[model samples]
Target: MLRMLFHPKSLKFLACIALAALTFSSSCKTVESSSGSLSEKSRTKTDVFFAEMYKKYNPYPIQDDPETPDDCQSLFKEADPSVPYKGVVVYFHGFTACPQQFYEFAQIMAKKGYSALAVLMPGQGRFPAPFNNDGKKTINGRKYKDYYSEYLPVKKGDDWKRYLNFVSDVNTFAATLPGEKLVTGLSVGGQLAAYAYVERPGLYKRALLISSYLGMPGSYSGRNSTTSGGMLNSLRRLSGDTIYHITKAVSQQGSNLDIIADREVSWGDKCYQQTRGFNGNPGRRGICDFHVENIAAINSLGEYILGQIKASPALTQIPQIQYVGPEWDTGGDTLLVRKAIGYQKARFGDDKVNACFFPNVVPHSMFARKDIAVLPETPWINSFMLETTKFLETGATYKVSQEPSEETQWDGASDQDSGVFQNRCDVYAVDYSKVSP
Candidate 1:
């Protein structure tokens, strides 16, 4: 009877039971796992910082925005503080978008035993309003019916400084947590993530960039004109200047065409219609309109990152980096995608950096919502999340060399073109041959 009790199978069974109990106890100890709260000191500091910054910039009544919370303009801490975290991701949303853009992604990270903090960029996440810099009018000066007509109070250099400070503060808080540190962003946020990784070498273990707004593709000249003109309109408002120079140039060409009309032609129609949220409903939020000032800021930030890459080639030090670009993204250009991949390859070598393109995905805000379905040919968000976690935990790299066939390309291919589409998306990887400097 003693020999039977001490059998190998019996010992193995007992070990399994013990492990299960240990896991259960650890999970039970986690408090506020879904909505992790920051310490009192951190919250106070965040509030004070934003309060002072808003006053300096044209103060928009951010508290009044229906979408924003009264206490904070951002969401932070998505994991249990008491439990040991697997990793921490500092996620930044896209230009003109709120922290809600990263809400679903943060939830996924928390579920996977990681912590996530989604930081709201300066002057974003609030109701769009035009500001008068002279202080003659209220911060929420005029309420316009159309979003395009609204102007954001953006001090170019000052705003970027505030953004950098916010990112640094969040990084400092993330350091207190017991886990690896990671940074990720979308579009302009992607540019900021790259900037953060470059600025602080060895601080972030991994970085993920989605459709960084480095620059538009060469073929998007027409679209670029409309976007650039719109951005200039916002700048004109804050500077209290007119587009007289541009108007004069157009007049000198022997045409009586209205320059302002030409700039406003594609005001609210530039971005592709998102499939989810208020923007999806034509009667509700209409289309996801791009803010003029926000676009300008994004372009400026992208330029800064490129300049940094050129200035300090050897300072890039993140261990693992992954860049995801959409094959059909209308908001960000494909040329910018190649530039992002090339920059990483140049700095971190081919082994540490990886890139992938979603075959039919077009929306710039691809991963904004959790319920939205991924392109049938691309891997699901869960797969991406798992892979991200794996990289953060083990520094594992997934490199795919399989060349996509012509049928796999997005050139009007039918859904039934190949069996590869039917199978689960292989691990996300970067194909170096596809990228060009």
Candidate 2:
């Protein structure tokens, strides 16, 4: 009787009811400024358009920190006003990252005669409020309970739907630009770019997905810690649930997943130039510490997209795709990314799908800043930008190569062996010999 009563469908319905109740209760207690809607405005009027964008997307004040860096905000780079732009290029930064992550690249694209917009992802670029039992307090002119935090300000399912909707909005805005549309994104942003392309076939002329988030490895060498993916996926398969039940089991009632809520954020400069104290960076821009629920949400999107690709016989309508996989990526499951791309290549052939794998020394946030990426001797970043420009123009990939590190090894069978042990080798061996950079 209990099993029948608590059937998966029943449980989901109950969860929805519970969530709705929580929402109603919280809305009564929480005070927040409305994220104003963008009125249909002329894109040519840059100031009006951007002001509306800021109001709509980044409305919440950074609690206790009034000033936010310009780089961290949604940014737009225009080509020479005199010259007609070839197209518009949209860039999405990694999860927890600000638009600053792609500012430089956006500028590059702009210089190459493409209007570039680096969009700030939802729930980013705002600082979280300090923990408090009562969900009401004013801090830095914003309601504390309304702010995003691990201690629970607000959460709705995996939050993938919100993200997808945001993507659609951004693309719709970009569609108004003067020319053909192109997009590039890193990490979770890369996954969103894929979603944008897949959701609206032929909407983009080309897509560049770099280190797309699919899954995380069991451990991270940088953090010297085991990740939740290993344990979470194990539970997911066992429970045959979409990760929600496992989150519910681990988290307290009303908080689906806050396993690392108490863990002190130790991002220290990886997130920004400084980390003085607990939420004390006066100019802090992006989220440094996020809930495990965030990870589960992103992974769910990845799984859904992968399933969509697998289910389709052929995605012929989608334009050319350029996939950039890091040889050594700790942020996401590179193996899964490669496997998914392999599926696409098999279905559409080599002409439609292209991939490039960077070396092991490079960090997952390689494109963010020079200080962040422990780069090779080669000017790989510059070469990469040039290659991207070439691709946008001609749908061609340039050859970039150097001998693999002596310590690199590829003797592996399992995904783990192939992922961590391959040591940055391009396992799929997408031929890069066709053109020299």
Q: Give all candidates' CA lDDT scores.
A: 0.47, 0.54
Off by over 4 Å in 2: 1-57, 62-70, 127-158, 218-284, 312-316, 370-379, 402-411, 415-437
Candidate 1's C-alpha lDDT?
A: 0.47
Q: Residue 149 deviation, candidate 1, in Å?
A: 8.4
> In candidate 1, which residue ranges exceed 4 Å CA deviation?
1-58, 63-72, 81-83, 128-178, 220-294, 313-316, 370-382, 385-401, 405-437
Tens digit of per-residue lDDT, candidate 1, span 1-437? 22323554445434433433443111111112354365666555544544444454313333122222211145554565555667777887776555556655565566556776665566553432222224332333432223432433222344545556656666665576566788888877787788777777787888888767664322321122223332222223322233333422332331243323233212222222221223322111111333233344445556567777656765746658877655434555545555556665666577777766554333455555421323343334444555554554456653333654222342233332222211112445443222110
The prediction achieving the highest lDDT against the true structure is 2
* Residue 336 in candidate 1, Cα distance off native in Å: 2.5
TM-score for predicted model 2 compared with the true structure: 0.66
The estimated TM-scores of all candidates read 0.60, 0.66
Per-residue lDDT tens digits for candidate 2, residues 240-324, read: 3433343433333324445532222223333433322234323324555545455555666677778766565444566788887
